[model samples]
Target chain A: MKEFKFLIAIWKTNLQSAMEYRGAFLTQTIGMMVNNFIYFAIWIIFFDRFKDVRGWGINDMYVTFGILASSFGLVSLLFGNAFMLSDIIAKGRLDYYLSLPRPVLLHTVASRTIASGMGDFTYGLISYVASGYFTWDGLARYILAMLLAATVFVSFLIFTQSLAFWLGMMSNFSNLVLNAMLTFGIYPITLFDGYAKLILFTIIPAALMGAIPAEFIRAFTWETLAQLLLGAIGFLALAIITFNIGLRRYESGSAIQTEV
Target chain B: MKHFAKYWSIFQITLLNSLAYPGEMVGRSLMIIPFMWIFYQLWKVTFSTAGADVISGLTLRDTLWYLMLAETIELSRPPLARTMSENVKDGSIAYILNKPYDFMLYQFSAAMGETIFRALVNAIFGGLTVWWLVGAPNHPEGFIIALPAIFGAWFLQFCLNAMIGLSAFVVEDVSAFTWIYQKLAFIFGGMLIPLNFYPQWLQTFAKMLPFSSAMYGPVYLSVAPSRELFISVMTLQLAWITALTILLIIIYRRGLTQLTVNGG
Candidate 1:
């Protein structure tokens, strides 16, 4: 509860900082929304021709995109550092976080907010509504799915970026990993069968962030719920354990720098 | 002439400079593997669903090879707009403007220098992946025939990006414009879906756009080669190049008047 309060306070400060440059902030946010929509437009064009691929139709795509963009946006919005934690670690930027009394990872990740995430989050809600699955129950399920998806997204990133503790400079690999998750998650999960499906569910966990949650949204199934919860919990545990282990090996550059 | 050597040396130096970080270059090129693998999965299911080996004059193999080539061209192009925007932001454009060489030509040579190895590596990786998924391209000799169009495509891309970069003289940052242009190119250029797959109306619309000339034409020529295709694609490319270059040079001249140093 205390940590949650701390996170809220930090997020508020981040929002204020963004608002100081309102024009730039709004440009970035609107630009991101337009970009995401255009990307989704390609799918619209695809479905117009194919109609459906293996029972996944345009509506399924809408729900999956909703789940994905929302979760990804929430992660970036609240804990934007998840995207660049590798660069932070490599540049010895963790010293500032370590010096603070709060939890290093939480404080570090939540210290900044990416304004564009709000755009993505808004677009996601619009996507879900456009999906024609609009019901109170559907809304509840959508929010729940988004939470679980966000858990997997952030945890997967942390797990990938933790390699920086040992590897030193891993920003490139981390970016590739990030792109893989985003690219793989947006596609129809039915497109893969054997080894590829296994990799998605395990290594990248993009399916957890996209298709699985989307399925849960389509209809309540205890089996799907169990899968989503297990995947989220497993990744959460893995991220925390890996990060703490890597933390022990961290060497602070003790570089003196100032922040406004 | 002496002027030609200066730009040529600039291109040569940038090309050699790219080799300095071979690991990073190769690492970046490795992106094509996942992309091609995913393409294979998606297209395989797509083709199997269509229940046809050939759709819109392209077999599944032709489609994959076409996509491999398209991705190489898309991914390997120099970050011209971004680089120009940065130079404008940091006020390095002042120093660059003072140099004896034409600003556009200098940039063009450097961009080509940076492009050569990146494009080569991307083609190799993307080609190998597609080959593994299916087999050799439909026309091995056609790729050689297609080479001139590929270079022409790069020239078209250069002119378009150069014009976008010139906009930085006023906007100071052109990221949003670049992003939009890139997405527009993807749609019009048939980066993800081949032009053959689109409905007739959309296919006709895309063809008239310069993006097809810049990206799709060369790849299309390689996969489904013909003298008609070569002549038509090359002609379109040449026309766009001429038009865009003239417009870009005019914009550059106008932009020079507006350029302001950041620190001053």
Candidate 2:
């Protein structure tokens, strides 16, 4: 409870700081929303030409994008530091988090907010509404699915960035991982088969963050719910384990600098 | 003739700098592999569903090759807008301006130099992936034929991206503009879908845009080589190049005046 309060306080301060640059914040938010919308337009074009690919159609795409966008936005907005953890680790900036009384990973990840994430979050709801699946129960499912998806997404980011503890400069690799998730998360999981299916479930787990959650939202099944829960819990556990193990190897850069 | 050598040297230096971390370059280029694999699955499913070997004057083979080349062009692009925005943000543009060479030519040369190896590597990876999925390209000569248009495509990109970068002089941040421009290229430039598959009205409108010239036109000729397509595409590319190049110059001059007043 105390840690939750601390996290909320840090988020409020970050939000206030972001609000100081209101125009830039709004521009970035709207820009991100429109950026996401434009990618969806490609699907519109694809559906227009081919009707549907297998069982997936334009509607499925809408929900898929909504879940992916919201999950991505939520992580970026709430845990923006995950995006830069590799750099923090590389520069030994973990010292700042270590010195704080709060839990290192929790406090560090929640300290910054990416303002553009608001756009993605809002746009995602709008996408879900437009998906023609908006209902009382469906809305509940959507929120639950988004939380799970965000969990998986942030865990994937932490898992990849944790490499910085062992490898000094892993930002590029982290970026590749991020890009892979973004690119694959939007596509229909049904298109993949065999080894491709194996990859989606294992290495990258884009399906966990996108398709499985999307499927759970569309029609809840015990098996699908099980998969989503397992994935979110599994990746979260993996991320925490990796970060904790890596934390043991942390060494301050040894160049003291003042932090206001 | 003497002035041409300056730009040539700028290009040469950037080319060498791009090779500085060969492993990083290869890793970056490997992105095309997944892209190609995904494209294959999508197109194969589409072709099967359509129940036809050909759709919109393209065989499945032709479409894969078209998309591979298009992605090669799209993925290999240097981040000219982002780099220029950084120059503005860091207040380094003032120093860079004092250099002897023309800024536009210098940027263009450097962009092309950086693009060469990245484009080559993407084509190789994308090519091999597509080939493995759907055999070889219908016309190997398409690559040779598409060379000039490929160069022109980069020229078109540099002009528009430079204009977006220049907006940073006023806006101080150009990421929003760059993101929109990139998405526009993806759609109208046919990076994701060939213009051949677009609705007729939309196709005609998108073709009129410079993105078609910058991306789709060149790669289209490569997939289905034709004398007429070559002539037509080259003509369109040249027309847009002249127009955009002139517009970029005007914007460049105006940006300098803005920088001088504010940067002071």
> Per model, how many backbone clashes are there?
0, 0
After superposition, which runs of candidate 2 have C-alpha atoms over 4 Å from their true positions? A255-260, B260-264
Per-residue alpha-carbon lDDT of candidate 1 for residues A61-98, written as tens digits (9 for 90 to 100): 99999889999989989989999888888888998888
Predicted candidate 2 versus true structure: per-residue lDDT over B12-84, tens digit per residue: 9999999997887888888888888888889999999899999999999999999999989988899999998
What's the TM-score of chain B for every model shown? Answer: 0.98, 0.97
Clashing pairs in 1: none
Q: State which docking tier applies to candidate 1.
A: medium
Chain A: TM-score in each candidate? 0.97, 0.97
Looking at model 1, residue A49 earns an lDDT score of 89
Window of ten residues with lowest summed lDDT in model 1 chain B: B171-180
- Candidate 1 — what's its lDDT? 0.90
Query: At residue A141, what lDDT does model 1 achieve?
Result: 94
Q: DockQ of every model listed?
A: 0.61, 0.71
